[model samples]
Target: MRVQVVIIGSGPSGLLLGQLLGKAGIDTVILDRSSRAHILSRVRAGVLEEGTVHLADAAGVGARLKAEGLPHDGFSLAFDGRDHRIDLLDLTQGKRVMVYGQTELTRDLIEAREAESRLMIYEATNVMPQGFDSGTPHVTYEKDGVTHRIDCDFIAGCDGFHGASRKAVPDDAIRTFEKVYPFGWLGILAEVPPVDHELIYANHPRGFALCSMRSLTRSRYYIQCALDEQIEAWSDDRFWDELRRRLPAHHAEAMVTGPSFEKSIAPLRSFVAEPMRFGRLFLVGDAAHIVPPTGAKGLNLAASDVHYLASGLIEHYEDRSNAGIDGYSHKALARVWKAVRFSWWMTSMLHRFPGTGAFDQKIQEAELDYLTHSRAAETVLAENYVGLPY
Candidate 1:
């Protein structure tokens, strides 16, 4: 089979990229090693940056998002037994974030693509990109005991960190930088309403806690815990009690507790692979970089990467120009590093690191205090939180 582009991975990045390119008259075939059910089952980020919202619209899947997604003008930062509101809209001059779950957005994209009969090969094993650097690129994979090949003008490595695409690059060609945090976030999804309308991020003596919601009726909460903490050790009551101790008295009092439908522990890490473009194979999203979820930059960074990749591909196909493609890596990495820095800073400020000395604690306290009282520091948080311009 022959197509203009071949996309690996059916996550939000691959789906979103294919949606944009398909609308531009560029034929794309999506290949994923996992079943659609398995892909949809995973719970991921719920916050959407302004850029992601527009990208969803461009992908023709924002109607339900705009209807159901909550728009938060601001969120609160709880520290020193109190709450400090960061005015996202006011600080960013009307820019706000949309609270739309990634799973729902993926479902919308899948429906849109299926409606148009886009070719998506699921559960395809041994997927590989070939000849990405020799001016001719193609992808091959195995499906149902048959091997298939797709000739394409370009390859999009949207498959995540462990996917075959990034690994296709030689070690010498890609430079990697990574920092794994000492703690992980134990998150729970409950049917109860959130304690507050907007999200609350708390920095307490115990650890870091986040009060977030997927919608008005569905709440998502996370608390920092040791890397060794096991899921089986945490029950609904124990989790609630520990969460309440981390939050302010009022929020804790107003909190609604219920049986958690989903629970998992996610380790924190910041990783980036240099030069997102490996010849004709352009790495998008998790294939290229990962940021800690502290600033909600993981999916947002992926959205930005998709934006750059799609724009470059469209320019190449529509205008017969390589300018966008030629500059893809430099431009994408420029923004990616900024986000990595922001997420790292936020994680450091909010979490209680292992063996953090008294001096380090005092420094963290000073930073939080300054951030709460100083307009300049608040604007920095607001700008990064709402997202940097695409």
Candidate 2:
């Protein structure tokens, strides 16, 4: 098979890029190692940056999001036994984020692509991009014991961190910067109303906790845990107890507890791969960078990456200009670094380090205090949370 672009992932980035390009009359194909059912079953964060919402609209999958996604103008930060609200809409000049799950967003993209009859190969095994440095690039994969090849002008590596895309690049060419946090987030999804209308990020003496929601009735909550902690060690009652202890009194009193339908521990890390491009192969989303969930920048950053990649591809096909294509890495990396910094900063401020001294704790408390009182600090949080512009 031959196409203009071969996207080696069916996640949001690849699917959204394909949808955008396909709408622009660009022929693209997506290949994924997972089945459609498996992809849809994966639970992930939903906080959508303003720029991401616009991109979803551009991809023709924003109707359901607009109808069902909750819009938040502000969120609260809990410290010193109180909740302090940051008015994001006011601080960011009316910019706000949408709470929409990644799973639902991927499902929407899948439906839109299928409706338009775009080709997508799921359960593609041993997918690899070859000859990306040459004028004629192609991808190879095996499916049902049969090997297949796709010839394309460009290859998009959206297959994520553990996928073949980034790994295909020679180690010498990749410069990586990473910091793994000492703690992980023990999270649970329950069928109950959220503690508040907007999310609450808590910096408690014991640990960090966050109260987020997928919908009005389905709440997602997380608390800091040791990196070595096991999900099997956390029962629903124990998890609820620890979460309540970390929250402010008022929020804790109002919180509802239920049997968790999903529970897991996600380790925090900040990672970025320099350049984000290797010849005809472009790295997008998790394939290039990862940020701690503290700032909720992972999926949003992926959307921005897709924005740059799609724009470059569109420019190459339309005006026959290589300018955007040539500059894709520099443009995407510039924005990726900023998001990575913000995520790292937020994680540092909120979570307790394993060996934190009294001095360090005092400094963390002081920073939170300043953030609550200073409009400037709040504005920075609001602007980054809503997104830094694509």
Top candidate on lDDT is 1
Where model 2 places Cα greater than 4 Å from the true spot, the runs are none
Distance from true location, Cα of 217 in model 2, Å: 0.4
Show pairs that collide, candidate 2: none
For model 1, state the Cα shift of residue 223 in Å: 0.5
Candidate 1 deviation (Cα RMSD): 0.8
Clashing pairs for model 1 are: none
- Expressed as tens digits, the lDDT of each residue in 235-314 for candidate 2 is 99999999999998999999999999999999988989987889999999999999999999999999999999899999
Candidate 1 lDDT over residue span 173-217, tens digit each: 999999999999999999999999999999887899999999999
Give candidate 2's whole-model lDDT. 0.94
TM-score (all chains, Cα) for each model:
0.99, 0.99
Instruction: Report how far residue 244 has shifted in candidate 1, in Å.
Output: 0.3
Stretches of candidate 1 exceeding 4 Å from the true structure: none
Backbone collision count in every prediction? 0, 0
